[model samples]
Target: MPKIGLIGFGKAGKAVANVILQHPDFTLDFVVRKGLKQEYYSVRDFIGVETDDPALIYSIEHIDIETFLDDHPVDFIIDFSSQESIFYYGESAARRHIKLISAISHYDEKTIEFLKHLSQKTVMFWSPNITLGVNFLILAGRILKKIAPWADVEIVEEHFKLKKGVSGTALKIAEILHLEDEQINSIRVGGIVGRHEVIFGFPYQTVRLIHESVSREAFGNGVLFVASHLTDKETGYYSFEDLLGPYFQEKENDGLC
Candidate 1:
């Protein structure tokens, strides 16, 4: 059983908690947020832990995260907070050698460098999208890149208006396809869950790869699966593909398609 601490109590957080409670091997220690003061929030109705307490948020102190980690600690930390918060939280995790998992839309050069630095001392599993199906595409893209180096590609991503824009996850796929940031297109509309399309343009015809997330539960399930394998892992940063290696290996054993 793993003692998990979750950060953020937004829509995604609530959905994740429902799954966490059902998993017999895991426990939801606490949830941390900016301390919203309302008569009631819909998310609070569903999740048991809803508070402004920073002490129980995976031992991360509100004022100074790094200092708090020395005193309080847990098995693993899941960050669903803002981008800035993740940078601070990740730095703290690195210092205290805590196993960190982030299933958010934050992925920048600085975060990558921080994770790489922490990998030498602690484990950090970070991904823009943790959904298993999407990870399979990421793996496939890597293989395809090797097979066809000059596959002209374009990416189109969509998310809810509440979400900023084309997520870092979609941009990551573009990176895999060797498409620059400028080539990536974003569409933001009302209350969309998540969607990404990777199209390869060719002289004769075109090939397309698409991953659509209809519900937040799908993402939550993937997070739980990753968390299950993350505990006691080697000190380093990992990706969804790394966690799903065995499944891919089985596919290879059966014979490459």
Candidate 2:
């Protein structure tokens, strides 16, 4: 079983913790957050679930990352925190051959280079959008574009009002389909989790590919999905498309209908 370490305890992290514990194929090691009154939190008690596993939570401010990692080594580190969180676990994790899965929405070019650099020493994957539905939408959009290269395309993304500007996923879809800036649209309103759609306009009709994240569990599910596939992979940089592409190989060979 793969031992997992989580770097964020936010809503998505909580949901993922539940998912990881519930999975029989993996084990939850520990969670690292900035500050906490307690030295450690019982995963089962904190999450209100019954489990024999002794997963715990530790505050980043209180623990020495290197020492903690050495004593309780983890197979993979799931990062849902800020892009800068990489600095906290990057070199240490790479030295231990720990895999990295970063789902942070955005990162500067320098941080991105560091992520890629760490891949040389460990299996690393960086996907701003790790939800399976969204990546499926991206893959489906790419295949459809091949069939309808002349189809005029428009991309629209909607998120909660406080979600700031266009999501990295939106820009990713736009980049995948080779759409212009003006062709991409963004709407922020209400508390909608997230929704992204690509419309292909044909002379007679239009086709749309859409994916909406209704809950944070999708993040955990996607992580599990990717982690299972990477178990035997060699140290290198990877993407969701890389792991998911093989599943569509048969379809691609069949002409992607």
Candidate 3:
């Protein structure tokens, strides 16, 4: 069985855990956290085990440059931790030559530098949203952008009020579209899981492509796919785009069949 470590116990983390449990080839090794045992003991019941010592951690919380390097002979690290945690873990993972998969979208020059340097040391996958469908939109948007180069583009994303940060996925799509930062908008209202729309307009025509995540389950599936794929890879950066090639190729093959 391939052993994997999870960094967060949030909505997406919990959802991915359920999917991992059903898989025969993957086994969750540990869930890392720093709070009182009581706070995450419930998590132990859900995934299994609790520990503060980095060496003892099946999953570690509060990952950083020094801590990750000190302990763990992990094959791959899945970080849903935090923006800060992502950068720290990412850098450490590269230095140690450990493969990393994360859902973090924000990246600074240093972060990008870390990824580029790590390109040879470890394989890294970073995506704001990992759901398979969202990546389809990304690919589709690329083709659409060339065809409608003159179209004005704007993005709107909605998340639950308690959600953190602006829409990482929204900003990513904007990055893909090469839109200026001012063209994107993020909204947090009641308990929405995730929803995003990319609207393109010119003169009298408007084209709107939207993705609505009905539940956290969509994210769970995406993460499960990542874990399943990454657990056995050698090393290099990846994204959902890499995983979806088979699906897209199958569609092309179907036409011939």
> What TM-score do all the candidates reach, one by one?
0.80, 0.94, 0.78
The pairs that clash in candidate 1 are none
Report the Cα lDDT for residue 107, model 2: 85
Lowest lDDT 10-mer window, candidate 2?
248-257
Predictions: Cα RMSD each: 4.3, 2.0, 4.6
Residue range 1-257, candidate 2, lDDT tens digits: 89999998887888898988888899998888876843487877888887766688888988888999998898999998787899988999999999999999888899989999999999999898989889999999999999989999999999889887778888888888898878989999999888998999999999999899898888899999989988999999999889888878756556763
> Where does model 2 exceed 4 Å of error?
37-39, 251-257
Name the lDDT value of residue 94 in candidate 2.
Answer: 95
TM-score of 1: 0.80
Pairwise lDDT winner, candidates 1 and 2: 2
Q: What is the lDDT of candidate 3?
A: 0.70
- lDDT per prediction? 0.71, 0.89, 0.70
lDDT of 1 by residue, 94-163 (tens): 7677688888776678867877887787788888887877888777777766777788877888889877
Report clashes for each candidate as comma-separated counts: 0, 0, 7
Candidate 2 residue pairs in backbone clash: none
Q: After superposition, how far is residue 194 of candidate 2 from its true place, in Å?
A: 1.3
Better of 1 and 3 by TM-score: 1
Could you tell me how far off, in angstroms, the CA of residue 7 lies in candidate 3 after the best superposition? 0.9
